[model samples]
Target: MRNINLVLMLLCTTLPVALSLIDGLVPNGDFEEGPKPSQMNGSEVVDPHSIPHWELSGFVEYIKSGQTQGDMILPVPKGHFALRLGNEASIKTKLQVAKGQFYSLSFGIARTCAQQERLNLSITPDIEGKGWGMLPMQTMYSTEGWDSFSWGFFAANNEVELVFYHPQAEEDEACGPIIDVVALKSLSLPKTTTDLLKNGNFEEGPYIFPDTNWGTLVPSNIENDHSPLMGWMVESLKAVRYIDSDHFVVPEGKRAVELVAGRESVIAQIVKTVPGKTYDLEFYVGDAKNLCEGSMLIEVFASNSTFYVPYESKAQGGSKLVLLRFKAANDRTRIRFLSSYYHRKSDFSGSLCGPVVDDVKLVSSILHA
Candidate 1:
C-alpha cells in the first residue's frame, strides 16, 4: 500500500511538469484580447486592469489594429492588438519557470514617433547583476518593418517576472517603441561536442543606432569589452566596424563583424576544447563595403595553426565560407581573425579597407579513441 501511494504521488508531481512543458508560460502575450482603444492623450496613463494578463505602470497606450495615434500607425505583428509604452512606462508578467533552466525570450518591436528608441528588459530577482539587459536601441532607417528580437537567460527562480520599460526617450516625445508577439520557452543546452561560442553569429551586441546603426570596436576608444560582439574581444590598432544586412551582404543572419574601421583590426574568442583532439573551424569572409580597390585578406589563427585567405570584392559579390582543421594543443584555444592587409595610403580612404567575417563555427572533428 505504501508503494502504491508513493507511485500515485509521483504521477501527480510529474503531470504538472509535463503539462507546463507543452504550453508556454506567458498568458495572452500576443495581445489578442483586452486592448481597448486608449482615449488618453499625451502623458495620460491607462489602467492596468484594462489589459488582461499584463500589469501596467505609468503612461501606456493600448491600440487596436488599424488605429493611429499622433502620427503613429499601429500594425499588429501577430493579432489585432499591440502595446505602446511611453517613456517611464513599464509592463510586466509573472511566469512559472524551472529554476536554473535556460529559457529564451523573443518578441517583435517597432519604433513609433521616435528615432532613438530604447527599452530596458529584465527577469527579476537579479542574478549576478545580469537581470537588467538593454534592448539594442532602434532607429527609423535601421529596420524596414517590424523586426523580431530574441535573448536568452537562465531562470533563477520558480516564478520570474518579465519586465520591460523605456529607459530613454527624446525630449517631449514620450511614446517609444511598439511591442507584440512575446514568447518565452525553455531551452536545452548544446551537446558537449557542439560549438560552445556564444553569439557566434554576431547577432547579440550593443546596437548603436543612427550613428553607425550597429556596434563598432575602436581599439584606442574601446566602448566596452563586449558591446558589439558579446563573447569576443577586439585587439586592433584602429577599429572594427559592425556591419548589418541593411548595408552589407551578411553571410548568415542580419549582421556580421567587419575587420576594419580605419586600419587593421583583429577579433578573437577563447573557446574550450579537449586537448589532443582535432577540431574543425569554419567561417565566412567577404567585403563589407565593396569599395575596396584591391584584394582583401583575412588571417585565421586557431590554437597553433594560422592560415591566410584572400578574397576579391569585385569578383565575389558576397561572402564565401572557408573551413580549417586544427588540433587542440591546449584545453582553451584562442581563435583569432586578423585583417593585416593595409590599403595604399593614397587610395582615397587611407588604409581603411578590410575584410568581413560571420557565421563562425568550431566543432570537434575526431572522436576520442
Candidate 2:
C-alpha cells in the first residue's frame, strides 16, 4: 500500500540520525562523509541531500582538505573535508531531543574571503519566543585561523531542526566561511550548593570536542537562561573563552573560563544574600599557560564592595588564591568579574589570552572565622 511505504520511508530517513542525543559529536558532524560523484558539480554540491545527515541550500560547496581557492588553501580543523557556505548559503540538520530541556550547539568556523562574516542560527518549530540568534564573527579569538563557538537554546519539541545560515551575500558567490565539527549536547541544570552560588566551580558547560586544543568561545551578552556556561551570564560585548584541563591549564576543577577579551569580556551571576551581612568572596586567579605573559588584573564586584586582584604572569602556568570581604547591601547580590587589560601570547602567536577564574565561593565571614 502507498500509506505503508510512506511510513516506512520516514522511519528509515530519521531513525539512524536520532540514535544518540547525549554528548559528543553529532552524526557526520566532522564532514568526513563526502557526497557521491553524481551529486557534485566540481567542488560545489549540486544535490541538496548529498551530505549525509545534513541538508544544504543556496551556494554551498563541499571542500576537501588542501583545496585551493585563489592560492589560499582551505584548512579543515580536524577531518579531511569541510563545508564552505557561499553568500546566502546555509546548512542544517534535524535530530531527536528531549522536550523542555536546554541544549548547546558547538561548531568551528574559518573565514575564507569575507571580511565581516557572521552566521544566523535558528530552530523550528519556534519554541521560546525567539528560537534564533545571530553570532558576530568579526573578533578572532584563536590564532589558529579558526575558532570554535557555542550557542545555547531550549528545546520546545521532541524533534527540532537546527540551521546555520550565512546572512550576508558577498560580491563573489563563493566568498564565505568554511564550517566544520558541528556538535550538540544537552546541559543538565546545575545544582545549588553551600558555596552560595550555582556552578561556581565551572564544572558544567557546553560540550568540548575531544580532538581540539583550542577552547570553545561562549559569545557575549548571553543571558543566564540561554548561556553555555550554565549559571553565569556573559554580560559584555566580547565573548569569554571556556577552557578545559585536557588542553589548557585550569586553576581548580576540570574546566575554567578565560576572560580573554579584556574589559569587553565579563561574567556575572546573581545570588541570594542576607541584608547587611558580611561575607568573604574567595576564588583562584591564574594563567592558562598558553604563553600569555603580562601583568594581569582581575576586577571583582559584590554588591557595594569592589576589589582588584593583580597577578604577574611569566607565561608558565601558576595560580593564586584571592579573598575579598564584603557586606551584602540587600537580599540579593550581583557578583561580576572582568579583566582590566587585553593580553596576547608572548610567543608572537597573536592569540588572545587572559586570566582564568575558578572555584569561586561566597560564605559568611563569621561562619569561616
Candidate 3:
C-alpha cells in the first residue's frame, strides 16, 4: 500500500511536467529557476547567465520576487522572478520550429519607470509570403499595471532566433521595460472547410467593462479601431456594450457580445475564403436583457446574401444557434451581423436593448462534382 501511494505521488508530480512540455514550447518561460534574490542589485546591471535557457546582452537587471528598489516596486507578472531590460538591452533564445508553419508568441510587459517604452521583437530567416520577419516595434505604456501582449508569426526556417530588446527609453536613466511569462505555441492551419475567423466566441478582447454599474444599468456603446472585441469591427452611431459571464448568460465561453446602445449596431469581419465555393455561416443569437419586450431581431449578411432571424425572449431564456448558407463570390467575403429590431418604449430599462451574438463560424460546404 505504501508503494502504491508513492507511485501516485510520482504520477501527480510528473503529469504537470509532461503536460507543460507539450503545451509550452519555450523553456524557463516563467523564470522560476534563476539566481538567488540576494544576488540581484538595483544599481548595477546583471548578466543572463544566472537565468536558465536565455542569452542576454547589454545592461539587464534581474528582479527577484517581493523586491523593491527605492520608490519602484518590482512585481513579477508570473512566477517568482522577472527580467528588467535596461536601455539597449536584449534577451534572446533559439527555438526549433517547422518551416512554413505558423506560431504565436506571447509575453507580459510592464512599464516601471517611463510612460513610453518600445520593444523590438524579431524572428530570423525572413520569409516573404509566410509573414515571418522582424515584427514592427511595439510601444507599451502601462503605468496602472502589467498588460499581456501577443503576436502571430510564421516560421521561416527550422531554427529561428526569438529576440526581445528595448531599443530606447524616454529618458537617459538605465530603467526600461519589465518582461515575464514568455510563451510560444505552434498553431495548426485550418482545414479547407474549417472556420477561419478568430475570437469567434468573443472570449479574447477587452476583459474589464468600463462601468461598474453594468450589473444594474447598461453601459454605453463601443466603436473604435481597438474596440474591446478583438478581431472585429464594430460600427454604430450609439455605443455597444461588451458583456461577460459574471453579468450575463454567455452562450459560449466566459464572455459574449451584445448589439445594444444604438439603433443600428453592426459587427463585421472580412475573411478569406475559396472563391466559387458555397459555405455555411453558423452563430448563436439571444436576448441579453430579460426586460426586453416583444422580440429581438438580427440580420446576417454574408457576401451579397442576407438572412434575418428573430428570437423571442419570453419563449426562451437563453440563446439559440442558427445557421445560414451562402456562396463565396470572391476570395474575400464580408460577413456582418446587424441589429434590425429595437423597441425602446417597450423596454423598462432606459437604455437601448437588442440581441446578443456568440460563437460565429464560417466553413465551406462539401461540393459534389
Report lDDT per candidate: 0.65, 0.86, 0.63
Which residue segments of model 3 deviate by more than 4 Å?
Answer: 1-21, 36-44, 69-72, 129-144, 194-250, 253-281, 285-331, 336-357, 363-369
Which segments of model 2 are wrong by more than 4 Å?
A: 1-18, 125-129, 222-225, 367-369
lDDT of 2 by residue, 44-83 (tens): 9999999999999999999898899888888687788999
Q: What are the RMSDs of all candidates, in order?
A: 8.7, 4.1, 10.4
Task: Report clash pairs, candidate 3.
Answer: 221-239, 221-240, 222-240
In angstroms, the error of model 2 at 111 is 1.2
Deviation from truth (RMSD, Å), model 3? 10.4
Ranking by lDDT: 2, 1, 3
**TM-score of model 3 vs. true structure:** 0.56
Model 3, span 1-369: residue lDDT tens:
999999999997666434432435378887666765554565343656767888888778777777776877876766777888887888888776667756556566676676656666666754543222222212221222454544455567767787888887445556777788777655554333346786787765542322222321111123112333556666554434456677566678876777764345677878997777898888998765545556778888888798989887652337899989888889999988877766452434344556778999877776522
TM for every model, in the order presented, reads 0.60, 0.92, 0.56
Instruction: Give the Cα-based TM-score of candidate 2 against the true structure.
Output: 0.92
